[model samples]
Target: MKRAITELFNRLRFKHKLFLSYLIVIIIPIIVLGVYAYKQSEQMLKIQGIGGIEKNVDTISGGINGSIERYNHSVQTIVYNKTFQKIVTNDYRDLVNLSYDLKEYLSPYFTMMTNLDKEIDEIKFYTQTYVPEYGESVQLASRVSEEQWYKEALKGTGSQWFSDNGIIVVSKFPQFSNDKDTNIVYMRINEASLFNNVAALAKDDTVIITDKQGRIIYSNQQASAAADKPVLNTAQLSALKEGVIDFGGAKSYLVKKPVALTDWTIYCIVPAAQLTQNAGSIINATLIIIALCILIVLIIIWIFSKTMLRRVLSLNSLMKRVEIGDLSMRVRSESKDEIGELTNRFGSMLIRLNEVIDELFRNKIVQKEAEFKALQWQMNPHFLYNTLSFINWKALRSDAHDISHVVTTLSKFYRTGLNRGDNIIPVQDELEHVRCYIEIIQTMRENSFDVVYDIDEAVFGYKTINFILQPLAENAIIHGINRKESGRGVLRITAELSGGKVVFTVEDNGNGMPPEAAKTLLESQSSGYGLKNVKERLQLKFGSDYSIVVESEVDQGTRMKIAIPA
Candidate 1:
């Protein structure tokens, strides 16, 4: 029994186990939500009623915004015509003529505005006086020299619009191309019709625009005397003005939007229960779905869990075999389920793991051989040469001096190459090696060429791949100077610390190689001793990100600089 439980535990995926757990946890409770066990019908009726109200109000709010947008477009067209622009653009003489002709040009606007009176109680555009005592109805043109909107438009600022009373209004000032643009035309809006349109258009609720005092400036539904009566008092408007709210008694839901550049809020109110009637139905249906889903899951899990458990347990045993060093083991599955997918992934992982183990052993043996080869290749001729030099010195003291020159050349070559077994030696040490090689060559072949070393002291501390600089200098000496037309050739070597890097250059005043030859020499094949080996070694150690720039002209000198990362 314990073995079977262990097998089952290993066989099941985490997600399937979680699903089985969820079925046990939620199956009973979800079945209960679907029951709707409440006996009271009144609460149910209220829920259904309020839900209907929300749907109605949502529809009304959508339409009212559309209607308002349409009216705004019409008002914009009437006030910003060409005639308005022409009159406003005129000189002082034209201004006097405009004052007379403006009323005729503006007559169409007034005519359309009067038609709104049929839908709304009243519409007026007025300028306010500091003292209402002077006259209750003070005309806008009388008190202010210019309206605020006209002032803006006069400077070619563009059109202006506002909503007041129950109407939407717009204004446009005239433009004078010769000087500045001004608003000479002021078209009044009738806002009362805005509320009338809202009330008429909104099937489920009322639309009203009011001041802080809660006076109804516009009602969209009715032009009757009752339209003038404010539905909400100052107190109720105060609540609406504060913001949108939910009234629990009415099961109401309210949404409000405030107009930009204004204090007024556009509020849409509806009963909450009505908005979610469909969602409530969906919620109830979801309870049923959940119960059904759980029961089906349980039945399916019971039927298939044991069969699945068998195959996975089989795979588990195979994996254990592999874990215990049986790399030949593999799991086989035919079904396309979560367990099957996982087994497939596991099989691939096992194959790769075995391959990696085999490759690792192979690499170990190869690395051992490489280390042996490198060891055999390292040579130190220094000891033999030094012993020979001591013998030569003793013979010279004994009056046999011919052997001294041979001993000296061999010693120089040996000591320079060996360098006391130090791999990363100083550049100065490298220069000494080059000097010894030159001396050896001079003695052997009677080679005579000028070699000058101009090295800076700052770069000695840094470690480098040894023999890099020496070969460059050697190549220059043997190939460049030896082949030159000039009888006396010059080999100039210079190095310095430049911008935190060691800049070592060896330039010989020999006949510089042609473009193709110089390129081939610098990037010589692996079989040859040239710049290619240096470049590859530097790249393998550092990366391609570091720069090796080579600049040369045929007759001119070659400049190669290695730029290392800071």
Candidate 2:
């Protein structure tokens, strides 16, 4: 199966392969992200919608409970008042005097209760005794035992609610003087004012207030006809919980909370579709934008893949030409892309190959010339040594010690410098060559400076480049000692083995060059031949790892340090 798949992929063109890759890498991810974002947004909207409805229900329930509490307090005030209680319990035969006393005692309590709450329209006291007829605010009951609310009020010990003419709160008064008649006191709140808070909700939302038996009391939809009022039948009400409901042919969020003072439940109903409308619109817009972006990206990929393939095919054809001995062919491209970089590298490789061929051809000619020069050097050095030996013998015979010493030093210097035509020699031999060169310099300058050696014996057997030290000593004598102002000049050569490397330093206590001059000594075009020659040779032999370091301060001294692998 894998072999078949590979063969099929190889047969497809490059552009088709790139298109397939774009579908996987770009198109698939966009679709997945859009779907995931929609789901998350939808869930968030549902939670927030339900939470808002619950808060509204809780707020309305709290306000209604507070209004009911105030009404109850009003009822209790009349029941416990000493003045009104006295009037109700006592009997008087004088109707005018009795009416005046009753009004005077209860008028103040009535005025305060009515003014305290807008919901309390009237406060009434009903009794069988002789009382003046003072409208509905204070009245006498002709037959009090016949009313249902009156019987219900008698059954309970405390305050009770009833829907007679309006919502009435009736509380029974105790029989103070052992009479067969019972006195009842009630406060009536208008039905419209009772559910005023719920009516202030949004028009689309429905609020219903129900008694403990699940019978509707005050509803925001009460203005509608009885048939049009929202009804949750017993079965639907039983099915309804606290969160969401799907009754009445519509989906809605339901919030139910019971009023604390009264056992009435307040329901806030919000439609589900209204809550998530904005989220749905946003999701649709996002999917459209993603689809448009994917279209643009695919177009760009098609154009870019074709351009890139053309360059690659061009490079392939050039490589074929070079394979068959056509080295003159070259690729030219102005682009800064990877393919252009490949062309530049190929061009550089060809140039280097040509240079190497030319260098090999020139080396053959140089090799023969070196052999001829070697033969000439062998003969000329023998003759020069013989002549120097003859000069030394004659000076010895004539008892000229200075001349004999000079000739002998010159002979040793030449012999060590040659070193049988080998580039590398022992440290001891290089040091001996420096000593001979220094003797000649001292003789020529009339001993202007002194030479000192602080070399370690262990480094004497180690190999070093020949003639490295002699040039440094010559520079010290010619440039440093010859230019000193006052104090006696001193030349010091030291060598030691450190960290598996040989370090040789040539120091001179003579007139020193400036710091800038010392720093550029090796690279300066005006620098003497000896310093530049030593720098180049060290770099060529050790590939820049070994080098010469020069440190100098004006009028102080100069120090040249050479470090090489031991």
Which candidate ranks first by TM-score, i.e. highest? 2
- The parts of candidate 1 lying over 4 Å away from their true place are 1-383, 391-413, 420-428, 439-448, 496-503, 522-550, 560-566
lDDT of 2 at 387: 99
TM-score of each: 0.34, 0.39
Residue lDDT tens for model 1, 368-435? 44543353246545557668878888978988664576567556655655566544556666666666
CA lDDT scores, all candidates in order: 0.54, 0.75
**TM-score, model 1 to reference:** 0.34
What is the alpha-carbon lDDT of model 1 when measured against the actual structure? 0.54
Question: Roughly what TM-score does model 2 have, to 2 decimal places?
Answer: 0.39
lDDT score of residue 320 within candidate 2: 86
| Predicted candidate 2, C-alpha RMSD | 33.9
